[model samples]
Target: MLKMFISGSIANNTIPDEVIKSVDVSMDKNYVILVGDAKGVDKNIQDLLKINNYSNVNIYHIGNKPRNLADKNWKQFKVIIDESNPKLFKDGKFTRSAQMIKDKRMVSEADFGLVIWQDVSTNRFGNVQVSKGSLNNIYNLLKMGKPVGLYFVPKPDEGIIKLTDLTYFENGVISNMVNVKTKQYYYEMKSEYEKVETQKKHDKKSQGEQLKFF
Candidate 1:
């Protein structure tokens, strides 16, 4: 079975309950591992899953500081984690680099990844952009041959781009582009990945059968 990894900025309300529902229906029986920075939409997604009785999902909180953690109103977050047996990597007390290392570890362990992020307009880290780290992580995962599905929510004022107007790529190179809406494009990309994965499994099974005869 394919394992899915979900990543996004919880501080921004980009991840919606609808997105979670869509993923649940699309994934069917696949295991979902959610990795997030412990903030706004991240908590929202978790809460929605709990309300919907999704007991098999695993959530990892990668926040390193109290400020980065979920707020007190969401104290149930811990209870949910405990009940779900989700892994907690609370290195927030450590350095930013440490948190980043944990993030990479989670990404490496996942078969596929979904990233939701918005491009930063200002230089928050001197000359560096805010979402730069996230972008780099996504790029690295693609370079390692992991299928990545990216969902970008354009700024509210910016008109939504049709799926046909967008381009997607792996490892900084354009793999394909579509003129449809974002969600439709996601479905198409996911279907293609599933087809490829199915072929890989078949090939592996064939190899195993050949070895058994030897």
Candidate 2:
């Protein structure tokens, strides 16, 4: 069975109509859904599933229990944390690493992913002008050569722009939609991806050159 990972910015509390429609199609196909237990999109999606009485869902969390599991009968996949692990704690909080671990697990297990992102403002990185968690979700999915369906929510109450499905190509550029509304921010993210890919290529070339000297 196909597994679909659904994630979104915690800033949005309601799911858009198009996103819900896509979820409906997934349900019709009896796909196993992998969702988080965060507020905003996660909680809203759970509510939708609960209303539809859908049970083919797995709620992923960080600790022994989920923060928000709408369906008690649904399955749970908890990523147990080690408080003693220094990497798991940032600024005296485990929230960032815990969520990353959970999201990574979801991305690894899913065949494809759908991300609902809100473009409010740029983060410290100034690469993607969206929620960090949602941006990471998209990047992780793409880097793993998994397809992603992105719903870009623009600021000032603009409607959602459903970007074409994207799959990373080794020698090709990152794929993105061309809209005057989102073009600038999209290219900003694309530039960052290019930098990473370039670094990887340079590192490999350096390794090969060293082998020649050996």
Candidate 3:
């Protein structure tokens, strides 16, 4: 079964028709989804599942209470604060570390990520542009050798979703098993499969240098 983590832009609440159809297909295939209790795409995802009566869903929340308590029947996992980062209280105000902790946990266990994103950032980080919080999970999945299906939210309220990588969904990636990891690795890679190749070359070069030193 495909286990997907759904995330999206916090700025947009719109849902495209293509996204709805993809969720339909995922539900039909008995996919289990993990979503946060935040607004934006998370809320949209909850709407889709609840309206369709898809019971195989889990909602992740931060702190003692969830930000959105729309689905009471949905099982929720409260994220424990990470002591290393230490974001419990700042100036008597709650920080967003709780959500980040939950996001990390979600990325660690998810088989694949289905996200709605729009590249609104003009500043480029090397080859890639800065992305939304949803892309954080997507990048983590890719770094861990997991696949992701991205639906880019269009401008001007066009009700369509487009995949950044056409060959991603075509490949049989959802059938793979998910690895259990305690931490998530968020790094810049070449591309989906290109990153694998790049990593292989880097490892080989490192091994060669080590042999010469020995």
Candidate 4:
């Protein structure tokens, strides 16, 4: 069984549905964990999960008042809080700082971490700042030998950009790729190379075409 924890700026909605779809198709059984915040409980993710038959998904909303607790979408799993964090509940909702803290805690508890965020120079509501905090937590997880997968969705795009564009680790250094288009091209070429190699191993060519490579 493979356990994955999801944390990101909920407003982005970049990776949740795509992550879940990937997990469903993978060889391992998945336990999808979500750190719920005010913006995390969107209809897109809920409907996608229900339609895809994700029976092993679990969500942990770190708020005290619990706004979407009784919703049918959440009825599939058990929702719990850390219980030790007393500052989470305030003014009938969870504070932004508390939500970020909870996101870190959830990242620490999983086997692997997945983050979805955007790269914007200016954040109007300051919510995008949480992505940096979440990325820092993910960097720590990578230090502990955990594989942290990151996906970024650029503004005005509906699909998830490649993970390699937003994540990398080398020579004890971690960084995010700044050029999205270039990173995507790198991955695409790499994949094509792998496919050619696999085909070559099983291909038996005729004598006339022996000098030519596929």
Which 10-residue window in model 3 sums to the lowest lDDT?
Answer: 177-186
Per-residue lDDT of model 3, residues 1-214, tens digit only: 6788888877567777777887899899988898988888888889889998888898887657777756788888887775445465566544665566688798887887877776443334444333436655665666677666666554424333333342442232122211111111112322444777889999999999999977
- How many steric overlaps does candidate 3 have? 0
lDDT tens digits by residue: candidate 2, 69-126: 9989999988887878888866666767678888999999999898887745445677
Error of 2 at 155 (Å): 7.8
TM-score each candidate.
0.52, 0.71, 0.65, 0.54
Alpha carbon lDDT of each predicted model: 0.51, 0.77, 0.66, 0.50
Candidate whose lDDT is highest = 2
Q: Where does model 3 exceed 4 Å of error?
A: 83-88, 92-94, 121-131, 154-214
After superposition, candidate 4 runs with Cα above 4 Å error: 14-21, 26-28, 40-43, 65-93, 121-130, 155-214
lDDT of 3: 0.66
The Cα RMSD of model 2 versus the native structure comes to 5.8
Model 1 worst lDDT run, 10 consecutive residues: 77-86
What lDDT tens digits, residue by residue, belong to model 1 across residues 1-214? 5656666654356454445655677446756545444565455656555565655455554332333423232222111122222233233243444445556766777777766655443344555234534554565566567776666544323222212112345212223222223234344555665798899999999999999988
lDDT of 4 by residue, 26-59 (tens): 3245565444434542334444555665555555
Better of 2 and 3 by TM-score: 2
